[model samples]
Target: MATKVTEMNEVKSSGIPGLDTLLSGGFSQGRVILVLGEPGTGKTIFISQFLYGGTTQGNENSMFIGMNEPKSRFMIEMSGVGMDFDALERNGKFSYVDATEVRRIPEQAKVGRIHVGGRELGLVNLIDMMQEGMAKVTPKRIAVDSISDLVFRFPTIEERRPVILDIIESLQTTGATCLLTSEVLSTGEERTVQPEEYLAEGVILLRRLPRKGMRSVQVLKMRGQKVDTTPRPYTITDKGIEVYASEEIY
Candidate 1:
């Protein structure tokens, strides 16, 4: 599972063991990645492991922006998987922005909510807040738990696309590889090009098949490199999400 890291300087370990092998060591160091899936597909767990794995490395830092759930819920959820969410924050190695709280208290969101610019924050303010958080942490990685809430808030795909693109583009400037999770419709093969899927440097899709409750991961699109696009079964346990990179999906 080892790759010549010296030759591929832009690749960094994804921290998810099996998935790393599929990514040729890992994803491009500072590109934005989209993790798309429906409910219960492990998108949250996958990204949580990314942050949790990096923050524990001592010198590396990470930030998680919870746009759909409260910050407390995120701490509780990840802690269930043996991740020390609170301790990392307390140690100043991890930062969290509660975008859901910003929705409830728009005015107070900017004072310390970490916006790119402003004393006023609203529902549309998260992209800016995320940028500010990125600057503060200088994180090696960043993850936005799920972008579904932001999609619902925007009212139309026309409005959603540009804003999402802006957020992804903004994160790129911070020099941190980012993972933005999105919800899929579960309609299978035929699908429209979502704004996030179109703009991201890579897209990893998680699906729960109607038969046998099987869950699988697919590397839909990974720009500028070859990747294993085969669907692989994955598991979510107390340890977290793991992809069977070398196994075939039944």
Candidate 2:
């Protein structure tokens, strides 16, 4: 008799109630997901809760790569949402990497000069830092606060593509599921080229729709997974992001 090889989908719970169902039971393991949204759309809060949830429930370590926010400010903001980032760090279950140092490198490469920004601190260096951090903490979940800042820092898309690819490859090697956030820039007509969306295994969009006087969230896409296509409502509470069921909202 021949033995059948069973394929399994690695899944990580989002920690938000009703979210897993929307994500086909959760995000697939070792896959990169791009979270797109505008400002005040609760993108950071959502990703933070994801890491905290994994740490608390699954005992999984997590690493957060911040491009804009400093460590102190990041912690303070998270604290206001009832997430004890300090405690998680103290427990060795969470880690943070500040990419601001790399950002400080001047952009010497002019348009068409090379491709991307001056290759001072390329993706290789960033990957090195990420690997070093992972070696020490061995996190199962990772989050890159925003890739848009990194992209803008670059001089051209050609240069940015390879660096982004390198980062994605590095994350896959770490065997950690990663959530990469990006800011959406519309061209007033239609959304322009979003390379990250194409590069990632899954993409989730958080958009603010102007309602009677308030805004609501809508999940745009989750590739290769069955998700709640209906735009569910959500709120930023003292305990982070809370997604309401479609039926419950109406």
Candidate 3:
């Protein structure tokens, strides 16, 4: 049998211990990670923990780009998880950008026009905003809360794919490890794959499964890393998503 070869790059801790072990030490640096899940499945908590951990433990600068939520609301949500976003920002280790003002580019030809909600803000403007944010924060780690929101704003999937790819490419240039959250469709219906998944270097899937009248959180996958393949139980506490080691089936 061929054995897995472990790379020597420093492991970036996920802030969640059990999860770190599954990631074969930690996530590879400067790679994009996609976090997909259903509502209330703790996707935001997972990303918050990741950014908080990087700032507190890893001592890495981080940035959060909000799509659907306002920056204030995002911080408040993080506060619920025991992550002091204000303190982190005060400490000069974290920052956020609210990009909910995206619009459509009406001047370009129909083939080139960027359409979102009947208003397109051409790819140039989108990239410009991202670049401007990076210049201000210069983060070592980044997260985009829910890429699905952006996709929905874009009238067609074709218009959205390139933008998503552009965002990923731009982040890679900054040499920051990135975590992007995406929403999955309702369970029981076959889910359509998002093109962003193919662009990302790693993927962590979170889901809520109905079992015996209770709901459970599970990790579906973590690519390029050795992770618990079993359905480990988890809970969203005041400190965020906590996975029980004893419940891990791997």
Q: Could you say which candidate leads in lDDT?
A: 1
Scanning candidate 2 in windows of ten residues, the lowest lDDT window is 210-219
Write down the TM-score for model 1. 0.85
Question: What lDDT does candidate 3 reach at residue 112?
Answer: 50
lDDT of each: 0.78, 0.75, 0.72
Q: Candidates' TM-scores?
A: 0.85, 0.86, 0.81
Higher-scoring candidate on TM-score, 2 or 3? 2
lDDT of 2 by residue, 1-250 (tens): 9755322256778876668867767877677778888887888988888888989987889999887788999999999998898998998889988765555556554445455545545454567778877987899899988777667666687777876777777788888888888887752237675777778777776766655424344455666677776767777778788776554334
| Model 3 lDDT tens row, 101-153 | 54333443344564443334444555666677777768878888867755665
Give RMSD (Å) of candidate 3 vs. truth.
Answer: 4.6
User: Candidate 1: minimum summed lDDT over ten consecutive residues — where?
Assistant: 115-124
Per lDDT, what order, best first? 1, 2, 3
Ranking by TM-score: 2, 1, 3
Q: Candidate 1: count the clashes.
A: 2
